[model samples]
Target: MVTKGAMLWLACTYDLDGGTLGHLRWRDEEVRTVILAIPTSTPQCSTSFPDNYRIDCNLASNEVRLGILNPVHGDTYTCSVYLSDATLKGWVLTQVSIIVPVPNVTLTSPVSDTVTVTPGDSQVYTYVTGSCRPPARIDWYKDGVNVTNQTGSVSNDGDEFVTTSSFTLTGAKDDRPATVQCRASNVDGMTPVQSGVKTLVVQCPPEIPTNIQEMENTETTIIVQWTEGFNGGQPQTFVILYRPEGGTKTETVSVIEQQQSTYTKEITGLIPNTRYLLNMYAYNVVGNSSLSSVVDIISKTNQECSYKGEMTSIPNLASIALFITSSVLLVTAVFLVMCIICRRKLRKMRGRENNPVAEAGVNLPLSPVGQHDISTERSHYDDLNLEEREPPSNYECLGSNAAANVNTQASTDDRQMYESLGTRSNAAVYDELEGPASRAHVII
Candidate 1:
């Protein structure tokens, strides 16, 4: 096979005697046109051929040559040799198969070099090649990476072939600004013609805001700041949703400026000593992003009020008053119960001291001596100044006044007993009386 713009030659030979007086003719079957003719009557080649063709006649060698300059594809050339007697001697056929390199490639689908599309959207791009022989092979590429699976078709326009290739582009945010190219090659060792670069702009929703922070706070306001995320190939703004902690009512605020990488918002008219929750997001014409991480903020207490640390719940005035009143009432009730118990114990102790014999459930015998003697003994007991006294021990009651007569005789023993009782402590005397009481008499 030869390439286009090359030369081709067709020759015809005949075996006849000398002075045969024959002529040669060349005809193209594709176009149905005669290209060149040579006659044996003339000494030189024919001058009637096209400027791109030539003819050579040699009667002695019995041959004729038809030379084609810049021959094209899909043409069958016929060289016929005949005598002047209108008798055909011999003929030859030459088929032309020329390879035409692709001239220029163009992207017809997108029209412009830059194409804008949203994420998850499919875009079709078509590359068409100029007319070529042995139809050009079309290939597609994206970001300099070859695309193996592509669709194409070839159509013949007269004598040349035109190839068309289509590529479907689908991508996400990460694949934005992708470059696509189409290449066409028809002949071996020929550089493939490349179409202009087509850029893909994938527009998508912005990413969630990051690095959320609480900058500053006051008694009735709070300041928040955050870093912006990807803008999704367009201008974007930030919005914040804020509310009191555990409150149903919410408020929304947006940044005044657009396309800023960092933003700050100040929220006002908030309650003092109150906790608040905040969330932020970025948005564009496409859509809004997911909510960012939550940021917690607590407003400061008023200057006159005592500071409460980081507590979300705020107690009302009525509740505080009620709590204090309940505590005071509980303390008063406990004190009254203690007073009643002490009074009852004091009354019981006084009764025991007033009538020791009756309290102890024991009977004591009356003194057998005269009333003067009893009075004298009671006087002596009063002189002792003892707060607690033990009952008399080891003395029997006498039936008559005769006990008085023995008083003088037992005077020494009574003196010894009195000394022993004097040695006893008040607690010892009280302990002896508190135990089971026995019937006893005093020695008058």
Candidate 2:
């Protein structure tokens, strides 16, 4: 076998006395008849052939030679010789098989250098080899790795064979922007021709957001932050879903800023001293990713008290003001009541000092009938015992002057006893009543 565009020669020889080389035929066509034939003497003849072919006849050597400048496959040459004895004749034939190296390789299906495809989708790439002999062998490659597992088909268009190879590529996230190429080889020991690189861009949803956490929080607001994941070859946005723990209602917020390594969002309108559950999701044009790991966060408490898993809000300004006003009023009322009581006791003591009849009745010993009357009277004055008492007119005084002196003595003794015991008892009662007023004043 010879390569295309190479020189090839075919010769046929005969050993017959008085024989001459007649003519050469290629593929059942006489070479001299198709082009120009040069007649020569008995020793030699020549022909000019078509398509860069030459024919020579040598009667001395009894050989005929056919010269092909650009040989192609499926070419046949036949030489016929005539002997001097007409009964003997012979012919010789030679067939040509030429190797056609692959000329050009190109991707026909994906004409452009780059193609965009969705993940999990299939893409077909077709590689065609230029017309060649002995049909070229086609191989597929992805990212410089050999993946030539599929068979190829070859068809003859006139004289040369064209090889077509198709490779199906499945789009994947990990293999994004993969480079695919096709190589064609026809001749042994010859380097294969490769098509231009075709880049496969696999577009998919963004990856799940990671490392979600609470950055800061206030009574009604929380600031959340997270590490952004792969955007899947496109711009992506993040969504946050938050809800109070064990609550049925859910709220959502979105972060629309582009191309951030770390994303942050502030969530407002939250309840204080409440536990919240949160999750994040990434979204793109293709689709949304799965929700990220759940995050547990708690909002800060206001002026609140927590007791036994229960929360109570502190009183507001109005309630505090009302409480202070009520305490002040109560303290004033208690002070006024104590002052009225002290003033009434002072008035009764002054009346007892001015009237000697009431003073004498208080110190005088009583008969059974008088004692009963006194007891009945004392019962009506049980709280203060300050009611006016008149001495019995039937009881005789010692004499005017003697009675005056005795009365004076008795008044002195009673005054001494009252000053000793009555003063102490009154002071004790006053102290007991004053304790509450002092405490109320302090509270006010």
Candidate 3:
């Protein structure tokens, strides 16, 4: 027995223990242990025994603490450790502490915005979750609902989370706006943080035209027009498909790229009052759709059998007709002005040709009349003899028989080939017209 104030270490131990006094039993398939009660009120009982006693197993690793109920220098202590079967107990009683749960969660990336995906395009997103130590698991939702499909989407690949939530639109639903979201979870399911809404918009292909209109009365061909909604991007091409308004698809139809998105279409070989449908589709580089829209064109018949006099018709709408007439007259005046300009140019050209001889005459020197001839009588030959004049330094062709006179320096080949014009003695005259044989001058 240990005294109340006496420090007593493990003074003794017992070899055998049963379930009676805190003898631990595994109760299942595990460790069993035992707890020995060291009494502080009986120090003499403890020290009175021998310091060494045999414990069945080594007890080196056991926590020691002052007894909770007893106040002593070190008379008694309590130990807590793994319950080993060697001692006869199955489990150990360990100390416990209370921990408060953290409620703060952080999300990164995948901002709150709409995701635009063309037809046949897969949408991709990136995000991460945070709390305090253990990371979180992420999940995606569509239209405020959870995604439970395993094969089609939401799979883990080397720590990278991906989804294949593809929505088919063509031949089904046209482009409609949808939403996508992300959810995070931890060990405690109570607190879950959902990311901001991510809007997803899907698209589908376009359909053919319905009703069409025609100009004048034409049965075989009609000008079809339609109103088209805004298609996302400029695609490679738009396919123009057409079929009879109420006829079967087996009938002769048309499909071409040259006839895409044009408001006016020429539908041929159709009977009068027949109906036809037209479809157009525009696509982007990635082949996404929501292409051009379609409309129907209705054909009209050709019928004309009336002739009304313009005099009566013109009188009724004279004011309006005059306004139109004035506009036409203004255009006609502009055309007349252009014609007058062209005629004046032609006349100028004609005048140049007609007066060439007169100009040549003016260039010639006046012939000397006889001084003795008092004959004031005008003669027809008076103007005819007006010839002998100085020739231009640059050669001018007047008469076919006139001799060409060169009057300046020229190449050595000049005098060797042709004789001079002024005289045989004045050979220098012909040399100037030859210019330089080394250099060739182009003549018109």
Candidate 4:
């Protein structure tokens, strides 16, 4: 376009450089001249090329020198040449169309090779332009598909047009990089100018963890484990929900943020010997995911013990029978030990009672009344034998052998004499006999 007060020139020439027609004079019949010129910026009654050009009809060349070209200069130029005469209508005509230049597209904001974005964040993909005539239309494509969440503006600086298109990207989706591009187009009908692909890196939460396992169990707790799928390109944590089976309320446990394949947790504060229901979920920047499948678990029960402090379980019928048998055996062992100890004590007492010293004290022998005198007159009595035997005093002897011996030793005269003695004297004579004869007692 030609601006007011700008110099401009318009010439009607066609492939005639150094040719025969090139040397033709401006008024020659074969030479062409501008028949019409239009500047759309001005009114029809006014000069269309007002002060912007000059018509120099010299002897050799007829040329129009322009001051400046602006948007008003974007008009069709028509030229004509007469074949026979200037007044005749037989002529060859030509036209020239002028327009703005094509645009150069550029990606301004995402200057680096790739742009990172997360879910729920508003990202701006800005497209700008270098100097261009006839401002271009900016279109955005995401993964080869056109996008509409965008805006555009165009401004001209007299010599060139500037265009800017900003695409605000926002949506909920899985984490993945997307290919994005911006292209510019205009009236020049040339190939569309485009910017290189700018990758959109997305981050979001992972899927629910699966394959929950009850690894270990105790009287008051359980050890649970699980496996996790993709992490959605972000770090994640886990939440575990647990409760007694068929109970109304539930308990919650959480795992610290992580991105590993497998995880484990110790779930405590549980009732002993109770059954439980449980599930797990994964958490990331976005939010928690759907709960995983429910699982069943049973807390361990306390173990019982026997009276001897041996560990045991609640007794079944068979176990009761076995316990009774064991009790009987233990009782029998205790009784046998007691009996053996009693027998040992009795044997020791009987041995002490049968000692020879005890028997000697129970049967002590007694001495005769005249045992001292007998010992001193032993030789005299032995020499005098029967004639010198002395009479005993006071007590009567009840020994049969002594009586028999006295009767046998006594003569007829002695018997008559002893019989004449009184009963008292006879008893006194028998009292003195003792020794082995005392064991055989005869009471007269």
Pairwise TM-score winner, candidates 3 and 4: 4
Native-to-model Cα distance after best TM-score fit, residue 433 in candidate 4, in Å:
28
| lDDT (10s digit) by residue, model 4, range 1-444 | 322334444454333233222121112122332223222222211223444434433313433222224314344444432222233222232222234444577777768767666667757888887656666777789888987523278777665678888987763456467778887766545676788888777766678898899999877879998998656656787889998987999989988766467889999888777999999888887666788999989987644333476766754466789999999999999999999999999965653343222221111112243323333333222221122222333111213333554443333333343343333342333343332454323222
**What is candidate 3's lDDT per residue for 246-357, written digit by digit as tens?**
6676333333334245455565776655666755554434453443444566665333222353222212355679889999999999999999999999975664443343
Off by over 4 Å in 2: 1-67, 70-72, 78-94, 98-121, 149-151, 188-193, 204-233, 245-251, 256-270, 292-294, 303-444
How are the candidates ranked when ordered by TM-score, highest leading? 2, 1, 4, 3
Top model number, TM-score:
2
Displacement of residue 286 (Cα, Å) in model 4 is 7.7
Worst 10 residues of 3 by lDDT: 24-33
**lDDT, candidate 1, 1-444, per-residue tens:** 677777877677677554464566677775443543445344445644467677666656777776778776666888776666867777778888888788999878888888878878889998888998878888788999998533269899778889888889986776648899888898768898888888988888888988888898887888888888877876777888988999999999988446457788888998887899999888888888999878888898754243575545456677899999999999999999999999999966764454343332222222322323442234323222343445445332222342454555454443454445557864554344344322123432
Residue 22's lDDT within candidate 1 is 51
RMSD of each: 16.1, 13.2, 27.3, 17.3
Instruction: List residue ranges in candidate 4 displaced over 4 A.
Output: 1-103, 110-118, 148-151, 187-189, 205-279, 283-296, 299-336, 343-352, 355-444
* Model 1 spans with C-alpha error above 4 angstroms: 1-66, 70-72, 77-94, 99-116, 144-151, 189-197, 215-230, 246-272, 302-444
Candidate number with the higher lDDT (1 or 3):
1
Model 2, range 1-444, lDDT digits (tens) per residue? 778878887776666655443333333334443222222443245443457767665545556567778765676666665543444366666778888889998778977788878778889999888998778998899999998744389899787889988999998766658899988888778998888898888888899999899998877899998988777767888999999999999899998747568888899999887999999898999889999988999997766655688877876577899999999999999999999999999977864544333443432222223334442244212223433444335332222332444455554543444344334554453343244322221110
Full-model lDDT for every candidate? 0.70, 0.69, 0.40, 0.57
Name the lDDT value of residue 135 in candidate 1: 86
TM-score of 2: 0.51
List residue ranges in candidate 3 displaced over 4 A.
1-19, 22-107, 133-135, 148-175, 203-444
All candidates in order of lDDT, best leading: 1, 2, 4, 3
